[model samples]
Target: MAKTACDHDVLIVGAGISGIGMAAHLEMMCPGRDYAILEARENLGGTWDLFRYPGIRSDSDMHTLGFVFEPWRHEKSIADGPSILEYLNRIVDERGIRQKISLGTKVVSANWHSDRACWELVVDKGGSRQTITANWLYLGTGYYDYDDPYDAGFDFSAFQGQVVHPQFWPDDLDYTGKNVVVVGSGATAVTLVPSMADKAASVTMLQRTPTWMFSRPAKDALANFLRRILPEETAYKITRWKNVFMQDKSFKTARNKPEKVKQFLHKKIQKALGDHYDPASFTPPYDPWDQRLCLVPDNDLFEAMKRGKAQVVTAHIDSFDATGVKLKDGRHLPADIIVTATGLRLAVAGKITVSQDGTPVDFAQRFYYKGCMFSNLPNLAVVFGYLNASWTLRADINSEYVCKVLNHMDAVGANVAMPYLADDHGLEEEDLFDFSSGYIQRGKHLMPKSATTLPWRLNQDYRVDKKALAEAPIDDGIMRFDHVDQRTQQQLEAAE
Candidate 1:
């Protein structure tokens, strides 16, 4: 048997927000630890590079979305995609992390060798197979599938003018002065309808159900004001904390006082749309936060509607005709172009086949530990951000926690650390995500379960997780640590 060389101290998959942030955290926290990032795409920006549809931008404000080590100085907190990509590039360039990233490399599978105390990865790098090993595996391979999006199951005949999915948007496709129909009620659909309205003859948002929508200023005046008086770091920190606090408070209020939050959000929408607002087209069936609320900076979507350049239609998509979508209510929307702003297909751990000592590690069967690591999983951490807030908010903390875990393991001379879930943990199983988004519902079975108690429970609250991941003792009894026995280590060394 050929020996596989151990490549680095840590191997991070997917060079997106999470991967980049994790690398930076390790550099800062564990100065001498060696790590390399493997990115499937050729570009550095993961989601930002993958998505190129019109008006692609962050739904969450950049203050919280931005990395903790880096301050977002851009005036528009709700920034466009290119700006985000540039920001990510800047981080990589400045930190000298770009040299460590291996592009066009896709991880196929990871096999953990207990005796070796390391993970051997099979990878496809530009069509050639290769192997690399690492003591610790970190997955930043976010939750979305780049190859396929959620198909809404609409049957369309060959009369198509132009059919597109936002995930695979075409560069040369022209919609100028042509009727456009955007399907879905999520953030993508909301962002597209208004953006396409600027040039398209008419833009219509078609949805089977409504999503809660809110509008805020594109620029953060308070953040700018603070920058004028306070130091840059101080101002950014204050604004970031403020946004985090507000988000946490609002989410709690929505969960506890659904009716109140519903009314408050609805009134904002009604006021924006004015007399043109049809409550049925904007009001969601479930309470606020049941699904993520669609945010439009400066009431762009509502403004487009008011200006008669765009409109919202609430009805079921019966099927797609050659020209456009046909409604179940027998309404026909004529369009020269159709944009399926449909949701993403969720793929956990970049769809990599993971196993421990010949036993397959099924994520669905395991429980989430601190929403970052999995129960009974050793020497691995998965960075899955908040479903409710800015993804980076969770990503930042996950990086910090991983660093702490590594430091603790090193101090104790432990080669392996795993979150041990006892049989008698006595925690009730709950759905991985409480959100009512269709995409999540379709793939909920593939997601790992969360417990109802502390440590095991996802919590999903930033404030709570901040302490749990950051301040909590790393040597907590739940996480077991051990080193490979001397005889086994000798055997592995001899084999090598």
Candidate 2:
């Protein structure tokens, strides 16, 4: 077999927020380091480019959603998908990151070549396979498999009508005047169902469990005020902090007193929809934030139902029929198009194959070092977004910390960077996340601690992570390094 070529200081996987943010920092702070962003799709924006369903928007505002250096200046707090995509593309163009990205290149697997003291990455771009090596691996794959959405689309196929997974929405599929049935109760489901209701003949939303739905005007008025006067970055700061506090306060209420959060949300619902809204039907049986809270656009969904445009059907879908869904309650709801707004497919370490030398690390037995780094893995870090806040907030801080560690490495003339190893499960006491979503459930054991109440714990609070990451030492207890020769044994063994 031909030997794989090994070169470069850093190799980043996936050109999403984390990848882009980390790349920006690495090039700026770690001068002379060679890095490349490899992407599977022939586009820059990962999630935005992948999902094109109607009414798609960021679940959180763009202020915190944007990179720290490049703040989003849009008037609206919560930006739609197109605008978000445009913003990312603008950055890629302005920074000339487009060329640094190997478009259409998908990372199949990355193996630690102990002999080289770096990682050997295999990628498939188009039909050609390429091998590249780097001293450090930054994974920003965003913990999702876009293809899996439709892989679970078989139940949806039972319907005689059109079936589409929001992630893989067919450009040719049309929903005009056709009755639609949307499944799932998360952000994707709510956003797609009501927006389609505007044009479809009718819409029926099926849910396995209920989610706390909060109503907010898509465009926040105060943000509009900030946009007119302050600089875009300043406006972004204002809006970002505003959302940080708002979401924090809102989520705190739910975690503290479920009844109070429900009451507050119900009051808003009553005021927004008035007679058209019925709390009895809309109110979720479980507490708010049990999973992820559902965000609605100015009660636009409720208005659709009030205007005789749609209806919400709460039931467990046992299967699908030729023209409708068969509920566990023994009732059939008809439709012309079926969209499974299901949850995501969970992945750890952005699906990078972590190994000791060439031996695959068993994720089932492994523990998270922090939310960002993995145990037993050296010279590697994964950037994961906040399930609670706009992803960019966490990503910005994560990249900053990563750069800080890299800087420390350069100062010490170190060859490897790794998580601060810890003994025991080392997991925090209270649950960081209790989302009942399947993805969360599947990988809950391997995830890092939430430590929402502690400083060491990743709070997803930008203020907190910013300070914590700022203090991490390259040789902190979680990490250790040796001179080049010391790493050669592992590298040579893997090569053999």
Report the number of the highest-TM-score candidate: 1
User: Candidate 1 on 444-491: residue-level lDDT in tens?
Assistant: 888887988768777788888897776679889989988866465778
The alpha-carbon RMSD values of the candidates against the true structure, listed in the order shown, are 2.5, 3.8
lDDT (Cα, tens digit) per residue for candidate 2, span 130-207:
888887788898876656642454455455677777878898888889988888777888788778887788887777
TM-score of each: 0.96, 0.90
Residue clash pairs of candidate 1: none
Cα lDDT listed for each candidate = 0.89, 0.74
Backbone clashes in model 2, listed as residue pairs: 114-490, 114-491, 115-491, 115-492, 160-322, 379-417, 419-478, 420-478, 420-479, 421-478
